[model samples]
Target: RGPQSQFTRAGVPAGFRSHPGSTHLNYMINFWSDRTPLHEAAFQGRLLHLRALIAQGFHVDTVTMDGVTPLHEACLGGRYACAKFLLDNGANAMAVSTDGATPLFNSCSSGSAACLKLILQHSASIHTTYQLASPIHEAAKKDHRECLELLLSRGAQIDLELPDVGTPLYSACMARAAACVEVLLYSGADVQIGCGPDSPLHAAVLGGGADVVHLLLDFGADGCRRNAEAKTPLDLSKPNSSVRAALLSRGPCSLSQLCRLRIRRSLGKSRLHRASSLFVPHSIKDFLLYQ
Candidate 1:
């Protein structure tokens, strides 16, 4: 028997089978309390079909075995139209997957800045995590700078720690996402923070990220600091690589850089946006505020 024959033989309601074409058959056969046709339509970005299913009484907040709602699917699929429609109809923006990933996390993973902005506008928590990984970490891992900036702009904590994920800076360094590392530094990520004993500098060296190494050093990372393994950033650098040379050539940061660092620290991450308005020269303001 075909896949369709098995469903009909099992006595699924006739109304469930009447939507016609492969769209209905593909999803209805897999139906359970966990996933309904509404989820399939949303996942598939079928706005008209999703509207019809909701009109037929499908619950907007319905979750699957994995706690995936239609909104999650829509975000994961980068289906902004479907996602906005679902949000407009009251899909829970804060619904988390069984793995602890929120729709915002899924949206960042999909690299849809529009989806992320929309979810943020709905007041979704930027701190939502999948286990220990926040959406910022996910954006860094995926090398999505726009998503990272959006999260940071809305006050996403740069230093949030998951059990083993460390801070977003460490995550970006390990991923060798140079642009992410730059943005994280400019947003005032603590270079001293680490996953275990490996600081962001160590993480950058181990990943062979030369530009990120320079960026971290420029942001005042302590390259001389040793990890639990007794390895400094130079020790972790690939043999004879430029990253090692850069670490070796560096001296203590200038007094001006130190003063800038202190100023940024005093203002704290939340007030960083106000640094530009200070009366200092643009160069000094840029240095102090991470502009």
Candidate 2:
């Protein structure tokens, strides 16, 4: 029975296995509607109490009725210490809650860069698909710039588009997460890879984020691009609104801006960060890298 210990539960997730070839000892979990003290301790970031509970035989992988482990609670609460302790004690980092959210997603939702990094260290790869709500998408939508950057640095796809959520850039625009939009754009996310036909500029206009709309234009997002309803970003803007003003003022892509876009395209997404290494003036390198 190695790491598989049977525990009857009401809402256990589909997968309940431990890390393959793990050396840490796994304990059998007890489940009930009231849940375990580990969940409480982890959610509150009570490291001393969590340590005591684990020492007293509380399973590190113990879950609730919704398949939420203490690790999920810890990440959700931004409790890096408790989360670290759980992972060290054989807790599953990839455990999904009833809502299809992993601890990594929870960390993003909580805006905890530390917890996100800790969970990423435990997990092997980023979730490229829309599964588990996409930690990258969560970070972008929640305006957690640090968490989003960490995911991107760890190879999370920048332009990952979901059926409903669009790309991370679009989601950021829709959520009015201006900083995230800028970060995604800077990180080489496609401005055109929006949700279905709706572009990030369209989303920004509809969401009333003037700053975000401007950033999209600066990044070469096509304001004339129409959505499913045949409405351009300008068309989506409200009458007498700053969004409309920004979109209208952008007019055409400037010569300098076009050159910047062209250069970045030639550099490609993988090498965008390496632009600084190019033997050029500091200002030229900064301009190329969007620094």
Candidate 3:
């Protein structure tokens, strides 16, 4: 007995044997899901049989086991036709898997400009927020400038914050994606937006992204700002002394010079307080002054 005979002889459910061709197709779908053929099909722009199978209900859009729909699979494989077929067959464009990933997110994350455009044209939300990672965040992380621009043009929120406090700008900065960072900043991402305990500057410092650090500084990122633990960007600097120096040496003044300026400012306030004390009437001063 072949595989089909065994499945039928084993008294599998009637649905299993009702349409053996569909059953075979379903099996192939699973195989394709694991080792995607949609990717190849999308690359080659041909998926006639796959489309017919989807039309015949062989390709279910609902999640099975991994919360991945056909759309997710198509996006993962970068198959634009498969994706279009899935979308036309009522596959939810905004469907997020158990991992909070959308087809658009995966497409952009994979750096497929064609797939990204297809999803965007089909009304995928550019500003769609996810639990941990987002399309823009993933694009920035991978330094896919074209994907990033595609998303931005579709109205992806440049400042969309992640659940763990990660932002697209922060991810771009951490990845040292200077082009992405420049695009995001030019598109109005808040440079001062802090993610969790680390600001974008802190992320750049920790990631040893000197160019990003400099770009952020030029955009008015305050290196002196501290995290939740009170660690400044300079404190976050690592083996890269160049990063440290670049961070410290902003605005024609070093961090040490800035510190001295702050100290002098404090001293000036103290002196003003002392002068106020000395000039007051004796009784009033005594009553107002606390020893």
Question: Using Cα atoms with residue i matched to residue i, what is each candidate's TM-score against the true structure?
Answer: 0.83, 0.86, 0.68
lDDT (tens digit, per residue) of candidate 3 on 59-85: 445344345666776787677777787
- Specify the poorest-scoring 10-residue window by lDDT in model 2: 10-19
Rank by TM-score, highest first: 2, 1, 3
True-vs-predicted CA distance for residue 28, candidate 1, Å: 13
Decreasing lDDT order of the candidates: 2, 1, 3
TM-score of 2: 0.86
Best by TM-score: 2
Which of 1 and 2 is ahead in lDDT? 2
Give the Å shift of residue 212 in candidate 2. 0.3
Tens-place lDDT per residue, model 2, 86-178, is 999999988876778889888999999999888888863568333647889899989999999999988888988888888899899999999
lDDT, each prediction: 0.80, 0.82, 0.67
TM-score of 1: 0.83
Task: Rate residue 145 of model 2 by lDDT.
Answer: 96
Comparing 1 and 3 on lDDT, the stronger one: 1
